[model samples]
Target: MSASTPHRPVRADAERNVARILEAAKVVLAEDPTASLERIADEAGLARATVHRRFASRKALLEALVAQLNEQYLRALHEAKVDSAPPLIALHRVTELVMEIKFSHRLVMDVVTAGTPARWSYLSAEVRERAELLFARLHASGAITAAHPSWCLKIYLAILDEVHHLPAGAPELASCADEVTARTTLQVTTVLGALGGAPLPH
Candidate 1:
């Protein structure tokens, strides 16, 4: 599950370096999923030995990346305020936050969700509950159908994935920034408009 909490004991400096490596890995690997750990070390401005000291092997590095991705995603889900906001409004905000995470951490997301029986889904309990409630709210508002409320929630996430179609061969990854936020919202709104009647007002 993408929302799994990580537990590891390390010195403060080593923890900071690990965090840096994971962040740099996101950008480097998003551009080239096959990028060498040497390249990641360069991006993080650290010695290759330093990265290897923290992560013994490429698989270990990737596992750390996935753990970091899960932490960031859980944070985003909590920050989305899905329960407190109005239905469509909440959905819009959630989509924006999610897209920001997805675009920035594209490679780690692919690693996590790559195979059959994907490791990623509505993994967080709070997120899943809030999503179902939001779907019910949207159904009541005629934004989604009356039947199969949970299915609607799944469809919402599926649509989000579909609309995030990255180009082939090492496209530059977008950061979780204001510009990317706006772009994701616009693109997703265009896609969801087809099903949910019209797009929500900007």
Candidate 2:
């Protein structure tokens, strides 16, 4: 930590190379689950040896990508400020954001949900606790009518799991970006309304 000590610098070329490899792997993996490491390296304009040096292996690359995505999700949750919003609105907004992420990265979400060994299955406990707290507030406020507050968690997971794996040709629902979101929202809203002590506002 002395001022006289030399500070080690990461070479700009190496930094760029790592960034390129991550970007290329994301694109290639979306299109082809079994995308070759060599092709990914070529796509990133790096040699196979360099890609290996950066990622070590395909599994390492995927795990890194998943970690990056988790960070993004955490940032989004923070920005949404769900805790400050009204309970029901907060729940809806959180669900909407989750759906948005799923739609944008359908392939990656699917791969992870399908028990991909390299990816983590759920968000960090802090995120989950925030969500559960929102649901508990909603339950207490009579925004939703669940005999047991834990039922909200069950419904939330069901919606997320179903929407994440929606088929390519599903029928469209109203007021949604696509058939998947629309139908999912409709089904989830209905269930929430039933469990929610009060009727949904028009």
Candidate 3:
């Protein structure tokens, strides 16, 4: 076998290692955005040398983490089927999924913003479409008398932002079924009230 051929597998293995490190970086940094590379390496079960070889500096690591955050978030939006459910159900389910995502991925909630990388813009557009579908359904059913769809969309998103805020630190709601249930109730109740939608059956 050619000597060059053997080196190919080594490179492939190195790439896989980098991916693992970045995923671990997501978890570590979400809990503490300033976490050290050594801590991240520990999270990845990798040597510091392996992580440094992939990311030369903290800035490089953070940039990679942002990209990873956007990718995972967009994927979660797809998995949530934000546009496929009935109007009210879509609002509740999408809110639930987004809460789960925000709670699970601290990096995503921390880094995603108005000026996030251009590639992530489509995710926001899809979310707005979800809002439009929901409000449209409410209008059709005579459930809301919102005269301006744009205003209603703004209110919907604003409520979502407040409900999912993580001011102290990244959320730890992933494992608590009772907390998720309570938050889901709060989310549905507040958003529905804000949008003038009728109360759903308990």
Candidate 4:
């Protein structure tokens, strides 16, 4: 078997089955972390055995889902290209993008929050480094004024935490998640502005 060859092209039915499984898992897991694999298979309209065949185990399925969501989120961030935009606008855009992803894939956010520190430690080095670089560039350009470089990370994590664990059944909050996100963005920018950073032109 070669790397280029999957031994064979996946059959259409199997492809559909896998896609359905992933989609169903995403929906159920986002709503409830304790959702069972059997429930996921049922939602996918597939046999439990079929789900197992594709995912091997529950852990494998969850890991695959998290990885998929992470990749998509990263792609969105890259497309946003905050570094190329004005510092305050970049912050707002990036924050909005992250909150959108978190809302859509709440399971990933839950897993990261619930997991041991070691599980998420890997993100700090790679993802945090890039974020810090973006913040540092903005600070250098007078887009944000922070006496300490670590403030950027603190602010980013705070916003992410609030968005990720939004209260349930609060239609008021749910309805205003977008507005809340926007307001939060502006508030952060204002604080940064107070630090002597100039706002980017709208």
Highest TM-score among the candidates is held by which one? 2
Candidate 3 RMSD computed on C-alpha atoms after optimal superposition onto the true structure: 5.9
Instruction: Please list the C-alpha lDDT of all candidates, in the order they appear.
Output: 0.67, 0.67, 0.67, 0.66
Give the better candidate number (1 or 2) by TM-score: 2
Model 2 has an lDDT value of 0.67
Higher-scoring candidate on TM-score, 2 or 3? 2
Q: 1-202, model 4: which lDDT tens digit per residue?
A: 5975773566777877888998998787777778888989998989999998988878888777656666765665576675676656666676677666766665545653455453344253446655676688778887766755567666656655654454653442433535556544554554465456676566
Greater lDDT among 3 and 4 belongs to: 3
lDDT score, candidate 3: 0.67
Clashing pairs in 4: none
TM-scores of all models?
0.65, 0.75, 0.63, 0.71
Q: Residue 187 deviation, candidate 3, in Å?
A: 0.8
Task: Give the worst 10-residue stretch by lDDT in candidate 1.
Answer: 168-177
Over 4 Å off in model 3, which ranges?
1-15, 36-39, 47-60, 63-76, 106-108, 111-143, 147-153, 165-177
User: What C-alpha lDDT does candidate 1 achieve relative to the native structure?
Assistant: 0.67
* Pairs of colliding residues, candidate 2: 144-196, 144-197, 145-195, 145-196, 145-197, 172-179
- Report the lDDT tens digits of candidate 1 across residue range 115-194: 32644452555556666776677667776444456676566666666656644222333444455565566554643564
Q: Compared with the true structure, what per-residue lDDT tens digits does model 3 show for residues 67-117? A: 665565556556655456555665566667667766776454554342345
